[model samples]
Target: MSNDFYTSSILPYAAIIVKICRAYTNTQEDFEDYYQEVCLQIWRSRKNFNGQSEWSTWIYRLTLNVCLTLLKKKDRQHVASDYLPDEASEGSHVFADESLNQLYDAIKQLSEVDRGIILLYLEEKSYKEIADIIGSNTNNIGVRIKRIKERLKKLLNGKVN
Candidate 1:
């Protein structure tokens, strides 16, 4: 991706990209890798975007797809909930509360699809927007978000099922 395009097209929405990347990656290095790949993919696939949805929505789908694909390729299992970084990673500044860290740790335990859904929901995306991004029906998105919240609560309480 050219510097101009990235600065112009991506910089504006970089926060959304970083949030999704942070949710999916454990280390600062991995997060940087995912972030770069997402930017690259968006620039490469720019032509395919025909304004079917908002630009941010397209970016969200692309970011999630890239992160999930990388996770599968790495074969890295979710880090144990008891796990905590010895020191803050590069992007740890966004989350200062210990409870937030615990919450994110639990989120990482969910399946990729669930993780994406929850991330979008937390970002305050409407059900229809989430459905469009995840390629699911709005009704399905609503049901899944409810179930995901329950599962997250269980996970946080050390009752993974």
Candidate 2:
């Protein structure tokens, strides 16, 4: 890859990869490793990108696939909950707001797939975009979102004092 590509295409999307990694990983070290893997995958696939989708869309698809593949491998279990970083702690300043806490807490209770869906939803991803990433039909994503919302309410409400 050229230095120009590094300076332009890749660096600009660095934060996008990090956001995807955080939604998928549970701790600091794992997030770093996952982020590196995503960078590698993006570089490896750049030559193959035919512009069939937007560059960002292609990268998003690639990122989700990498995370999901890692998640499905028994040997690659993401067991770094104990290594969570201080910045992402339950009491972290970034998430000091009550609704943010409730959302993340509810998210943590969801299965990995559900968590991914909810994160995409919260990111304001179109149902079509999320369905494409997850291999689900676009028409069904809205129903799934509604169900996930109901489940989130139940999950969090059950924990309240």
Candidate 3:
């Protein structure tokens, strides 16, 4: 990808890429790797974008797909680490708030598809938009989100296994 394209198109949405990648990775090394892979895929797949959705929506879908793919490959190689590093030490302000970090910790316990759904929901994406990104109907997306929220609540309350 051209430097101009990277600066103009992808840099503005770096936070979206970072947030999705952070959710799927365990350590700082994996997070950086995932972040770089997502950006590269976005640049490589730029031509596949057809303008059917907003640019951010396309980015979200692409970022989620790349992270999920990389995560599955990692899972196949070995189990993911249960430990989370201090976000401060990683030099990322994304999870600066303790409560937010706790929330993400709970989120990590969810299934991969659920992880994507909840992340999109938390971003305040409309159910239709989420459904589109996730390839599900709006009604199904609504139901799954309700269940996911309940599960997350249990996790946060230390009630889940």
Candidate 4:
């Protein structure tokens, strides 16, 4: 992608991409890979956008889809790491706050779909918008968010393993 296009289009929403990628990756290396892959896919698929949704909404959908796909592929590869490296932990400034790090750790324990749902919910996307991005009904999104919130609470409270 051209620098002009990236700067003009994708740069404004870099934080959104970072948040989605961060939620899906455990290490700084994976996070950087996911971020680059998402941006590349967004540029490659730009022509496919139909303008039916707002640009930011489209970005959200695309970012989530890319992250989910990459995550599944990584799962299939079965790469395992028992501990986070010091470099990775130090580099991830996004989780600088201890509470935020705990929240993300709990989020990582959720199912993939729940991870997406909760991330979108945390971003404050409306029920209808989340349903659209997740390709689910609004009622289902509402219910899932409620359950996910409760689950997160349990996790944070040390009530669930």
Candidate 5:
């Protein structure tokens, strides 16, 4: 990707990409890798964007799709434990809040689709917007969000086994 594109097009939305990537990755290294791939894919696929939806919406959909797809591929090509980072590298800001960390840890436990749904919901996207991004029925999105919230509450309370 060009530096101009990275700075102008992708960098402006890096926070969104980072949040989506964080939801899908367990380790700092994995988060970096997924973030990079998502940026690359977004640039490569930019032409395919027809401007039917808002730019942020398109970016959200692209980020979630890239993270989930890369996660599945990573699962198939498992790396040895020795290669994994021992402790998270210190710049990620994800651990800044004790409660936020717990919330995300719980979010990470959700299935891929559920994780994306909850992340979008947490972003304050309306149910209709989330349905548009996730390509689910709006009515179903409300039901799913309610269920995901309950699941997350249980997770937070240490009730999930």
Candidate 6:
């Protein structure tokens, strides 16, 4: 693709990519590093597009793979949760943001595979799509999601192990 095409089409999605990276990384520096790695992977995979899925979908999958692999390599230590816009603006008083952040904090405590599933679920990706991206089957997603939800709830309730 031409530089113009990349700049116009791909670069604009940088924020969404950053958001995804934030969910995949715990530290500010790791977030930036992972974001750059996503860029490099996208560039490397640009010509490999087979047009089987939408371009956006392909980008999502590619970046997700990059993130999950990174998580695996690091043993899924921790990752940041996204705060709602208003909560982010206000900086620490909103119940909803606190709840969501707490939930994410709990999620960060999960095994890497579980964390990957929960992260995708929070992103609202469908089971089938998640399965495709995560290399799992649809049937397994439900049970896994249920268990993960229960675990998060326990964590939020301060039932820490």
Off by over 4 Å in 3: 79-94
Reference-based lDDT, each prediction? 0.85, 0.71, 0.85, 0.87, 0.85, 0.71
- Give the alpha carbon lDDT tens digit for every residue of 9-118 in model 2: 77887766666666665556666778778878888889899987678777777877787666566235546663443345455422246776556656656667777778
Candidate 3 residue 39 Cα shift, in angstroms, is: 0.2
Better of 5 and 6 by lDDT: 5
Residue-wise lDDT of candidate 6 within 1-161, one digit each (tens)? 46876697579777657656666665666677888888888888888999887676677778878987886666545344442222332333212466665655566677767876787787788998778767889989988999989988887788875
Question: What is the Å distance of residue 144 in model 4 from its true position?
Answer: 0.5
C-alpha lDDT (0 to 100) for residue 104 of candidate 4: 82
TM-score against truth, every candidate: 0.83, 0.73, 0.87, 0.89, 0.88, 0.71
Best by lDDT: 4
Candidate 6's clash total is: 0
Q: For residues 1-161, write the lDDT of model 1, one tens digit per residue.
A: 78999998899989889888888878877888999999989999999999988999999999999999997776655455534432334355346777877777777778889989999999999999999999999999999999999999898898883
Candidate structures ordered by TM-score, highest first: 4, 5, 3, 1, 2, 6
The reply for model 6, stretches above 4 Å from the true place, is 1-16, 72-100
Model 4 stretches with alpha carbons more than 4 Å out: 79-94
Candidate 4 lDDT over 1-161, as tens digits, reads: 99999998999999879888888887778889999999999999999999998888899999999999998787677655634333344446456788888888888778888988999898899999999988999999999999999999999999998
TM-score leader: 4
TM-score of 2: 0.73
Q: For model 6, state the Cα shift of residue 80 in Å.
A: 20
Better of 1 and 4 by TM-score: 4
Off by over 4 Å in 1: 76-96
Give the clash count for each candidate. 0, 0, 0, 0, 0, 0
Model 6 TM-score?
Answer: 0.71
**Alpha carbon lDDT at 116, candidate 1:** 93
The digit string of per-residue lDDT tens for model 5 on 1-161 reads 89998999899889889889988776767888899899999999999999999988999999999998997787678766633321332344345786777777788778899999998998899999999999999999999999999999998999985
